[model samples]
Target chain A: MKKESQFTPFVEKTHFWGSIFSVLAIIVLVSVPVSIMFYLNVRPEISDVLKGFWGVALIFWPTALIEICFYTPMMGAGATYLSFVSGNIANLKLPCALNAKNIVKPKKGTDEEEVVNTIAVATSAIVCTVVIAAGVLLLSPILPKITAEGSVFGPAFNQVIPALFGALLGGYLVQYWKLSILPIAAATLIVILAPTIGTGALIPICVILSIVGALLMYNNGLLTGGVKPENPLKGLVKKDK
Target chain B: MDFKESKFMYLIAFIVIAFVIGQSLFFLIRAYNHGKKIGLSAKKMKDAITASALFTIAPAVSILATVVVLASSLGTVLPWIRLTVVGNLQYEVTAAQNAMEAFAGSGKAVAFGQDITDPTVFSAVAWVMTLGVILSLVLCPLLLKKIQKKVGKVKLDSGSDNKFGDIITAATFIGLISAFVGTSLAGKASTIEENGVKQATGMGAGVMSLAVLLTSIILVVILQTLCKKFKWDKFEPFVMPISMFAGMGMAMLVYAVLPESISMLEWRPAV
Candidate 1:
């Protein structure tokens, strides 16, 4: 039997509330369209809804599943739940969590790390929400100027992903130059060849590649300061006093 | 009934947005209180909050650009709700487009940016967008514990001597960032016609994107170095936001200085 004390009280509470909020958010999200139909007196055919849904689900569902698996380990329970619910994990939440974690240098898997990630994710969610709300009200006047021909905003907005990622990558490269080489080289080559694979799909593949590269480097004595020492503890585990 | 930008739609959007805000606050307070109990310094907590909020503003504005693009066809409220909640611009736009086409009923291809006159079409897009991502939300509550436990095991097995945990974490993030860096550097350009407007997408926006990216990298590197040198611990949080806006400003400057052939291509609505 598994021990009941494996998880701390804080983690247990986080799970309970996270599950509840996740379920509630889904119910509320679904209710919006249903409410719209009720108010407008128009019923969309079930077949149509399924058709549209299956098409997107074919793509998004698998990608989202991959994201959850990849990201959950880094994000603690609370951040995982809130981030999935609030969305924009890759572009916004993940970066925010990473920045906080790096700056604070919390030990992995500790309550402090969990709290830091949760706080970062939650704060990002709130700010994004408020900003969007404000933007909606204020965007009407500037909409044309933004979308108009030769609009600087259009080009600038288009470059956001690159600009954002570049800064992030700059920091990481400086810190983890060895780990950075393989993944950057491989991903750059792959994307140049097939730009259509999409970032979501590429994330998992690149992550696996990076792990393999790190393992290879560590095995080859490349990571051990040029000394490939033998396994010092080989066969020594059975010495029970 | 007027479905697009109706008072009713705005009200619905407001309610949903309010719920989202509440959820964020709920987690924020819980995490904040937990930090206190866990011996996190007050400065660390404040930095987390302040930095995250500051970092969010630029990206949120970019998201606002997505909302504006979608609003002309879907209406302000729907896009507003979609972007604010569990949907991204790419997924929402694609899902809504797929739904619109599926609901066409006449076998006619329905492109985005066409005014959604029929409430049925609007409802279909909404349903598809909502339900397509339902699994993500469902899976989190169901599988998060298992995933966390598995990852925790990896951490434990790594022990004190092995740097496996650190290596894996750094590698994972490096891999993710590298992919984006590759894409940005390659500048894959493509054109799509939406609502008879030809939009040049991808880094194909010319050297402009690449320039912005490099500028951001340089700015962040400089800022981080300066912060470390000057012991500007108080100003550390501003590094990302400063680089982001500077990168954006770089884009505008690049566009203005360079000609259309070398900079971003001039695209316009189709006649």
Candidate 2:
């Protein structure tokens, strides 16, 4: 009989809790508005709720599905449960986890990487929740300064997303130069030429394109050696171990 | 029971927030224990926690801005609760507007805040926003394990183990980055009238955003180059936020030089 890896039971335990907590999350989230309506003795008309939901769901539902399918593999098990529940995957949790994984240099498809990702994402969720709670508590005083028009911080705040993506892309370009070309070109053309595709749609299309592009490149013998040969910049940075 | 900010509403917000925090702590502790049991060093684990916590601060502040903008219409409690959970500014704002438009039965614009005095409209907005994102939450609990298992199978079947997995992960990341970069770079030029002055707006605004993007990239590259040369491994975690702030600072500087017709700042409409 083959002895099982020690990490197998840990991974199983994580999934068990992941499922339970995710269900708990769904229940708590759904119950909020339901409980509110009951307490207030007011119920929104089904027609109104459906119509409103349709307007947003028409775009978001597909995007949400794509996001889950796309992000789950990258985020791993425990991180996936916490991230999906906490939200802000792209702008917050994903980046945090990716950076942590990069710093740790854990082997991909390994238990160590999964543990690193979960820790990073969980920390991000905790920090984000605490910060938002504090902000809400101090909303009366801090809101005006943060939201003030023409404040010097205004431009800085507006540029956060662009800056974030830029820094992340810089690291990616250095690490994945060979695999980067087709997706970048495709995405650029879509944005420039199509102009009709929504931002939500653009992400999944580009993701699919990139996956196909990389697979083709890999099969063609253009890519090899598990991120070592491609990342010239990695040579410049000395790893401690 | 006012539709706007109320004490009872704050109570609801607190309850939801408690759940959010509890869930986060539960996951954090579980991951920490698993990491320790599996031979990950305590130093590395602590570093990940510190780095992730520090990285979250700036983005959390940006999210705070969304909560403030939504608060003007949806009340402090609702926006606070929504943004804290599985909601973002783009979705919440659009859902609320759509709900109001549906209630009005006209395609014409419907303002929120004081105008949303009706309890029915408020409930409708709440329901729509909640339901719009429910699919992701529902699918996650049901499908995540299957999805991850499939990915694991693909890695095993491919015979490359880490190579194929690395390529896929890198490709996914590059694909996402390309979309955002291309959007920021490819914004169309448009003329807009502001304060009785007609001026170029859209493309110029895009240019300013591009400048910020470039600045961040350059800063990261420079810092990374230095980190490489000097082997400042300890400074590695700070690179993301430092580059981000550098880019944001450059944005303000660039905005100062541009004409007032081009508002570098994003302005939410007042209720």
Candidate 3:
């Protein structure tokens, strides 16, 4: 009984449209070089072809390739694994008394299972935040060149990003989800207030805030609220056994 | 210096090894428990174990192999970029610049796409990129199948179409914007050096790199979360684009880390 509404992202089949745009974008990008190469009509040398194969063939060795993707994807991937694990625990499934109406109420002939919609935007933000923070740190030694004079217009865009993340964060923040507001609010405040702590401090603070925010949300019973009955894995297992 | 001897290479080595070994152990145990929990067939369970292990280890294999080949070969090929017929131990330049020279000397700096019309050293680099994508596509399915066996019933693809396209789209936008921003900042930073001016700044290529790194982690954690949120489990579609974005982001970072040879950010006393 799954409708098409549940099959897409954001509003409508936006993923479909977005993917179309992405393909078009790549096509445009890839075409420019290809067109020039065609017009110039230069064939690749045998030795060059051999070299191309060699580099690609080398990637099969895990002992060497993981770091190339940057450190964030690794951690971010690990976080997904943890959340999956967390989802499996019995204690995690205990129905909250606070949301009894939402939890227990069911329409006639409707599936009685409680399914919480796992918001993609919230999780996407979480992973991106960690990875981007780490990348910034790795690049810290060489940034002065670009940032020094870059700061002129920076006076404007500096506010743009945080303001955006803040609004995005608000859209996902739920009452039963956890006191994530505390951490999100703390992070925003720190960025705005404690400019002295600088770039390096931002990561640790954000991490702490996210953790605290999650904790607060959990304590406030927002975790229960965040769970929409539509979550595929929801209520499939009984914990009291 | 050989890539093996470089700090970056060493770091990559350590991580690949750790991830392959570590994730395998954790998920293998998890697979076993999951099998026990769901009353799945022993054969299915065994398959899941193998699948999970492959999932953990395969990418490391592909990445390592790809990098090593590129590095080792690039080492040899780069000399050809500036060939010298050293007559009797005396370093003498026979040929000044060849096709590769033409490419670099063309003077139009559109880095996103380097000129391939003239087959040169840079073209060879481009070839490596072309082949890398091919290798990944060819080898990934085999690896994914092996991993599926290890995971028991778990699949990277939930077999439903969710917001994957949107996620990738957003990621690309994120990467492109970040790169452009870094480029401008780099320009302005040079301007600061020119104007004999300097000041502390809150963001720049450094922040962008940080943002990209953050974005990658966010994508990884969230990609699957996205699947769960949107109830779509097809990861390969998103991973490919994400990997591309990550690569672009990394390249920008490499550019950002260049030494201040231009004295772009150095403070100077007013005359």
What tens-digit string does per-residue lDDT give for candidate 1 at A76-165? 899989998888889889988988786777878888888999999999999999988887888766865874547866667767787788
True contacts kept of 2: 0.73
lDDT of 2 by residue, B152-260 (tens): 7656555444566677889988888777776666644333222234433223226567788898888887887788889998888788778887887887888788775
In candidate 2, the second chain superimposes onto the true chain B with a TM-score of 0.84
TM-score of each prediction = 0.93, 0.87, 0.26
Per-residue lDDT over A1-241 for candidate 2, one digit per residue giving the tens place of the 0 to 100 score: 9865333676777888888887887887888788668766797789878988898899899989888888888888888888888888887888889878877777777778889999999899889988888887876567658655467777787677778888887777666878778887888788677654656788888888998888777766678753333332233244322
Q: How does each model score on lDDT?
A: 0.80, 0.76, 0.28
Cα lDDT tens digits, model 1, B1-271, are: 5568789899888888888889989988988898898889989899889888888888888788778777767888888898888988567767777787685556544667778787778877888888988888899889998888877765654555446557767888888888777767663654445765665443452477678888988888888889899999988877777787788888888878887777764222112
> Least lDDT summed over 10 consecutive residues: which range in candidate 3 chain B?
B83-92
Least accurate 10 contiguous residues by lDDT in model 3 chain A:
A88-97
* lDDT per residue as tens, model 3, B1-271: 4431335423432332233234324433443443354454444333322322222121212212212222222331222111100000000010111122222333521121122222344444433333332322222222322332332122123223122222222232222222222222221121111112343222332334334434443454455355557865334223323432443344344335654342122222111
When sorted by TM-score, best at the front, the candidate numbers are: 1, 2, 3
Tell the DockQ for candidate 1. 0.65
TM-score, candidate 3, first chain: 0.29
Kindly list the per-residue Cα lDDT of model 3 for residues A1-241, writing each as its tens digit: 8654322122122223323333332333233224324533555565644544454345322311221122112122222222221110000111110011122222211111111111111122222222222323353233333223343322222222222222122222222123333443454355334433322234334444454444344334455455422332222233213
Best of the candidates, lDDT: 1
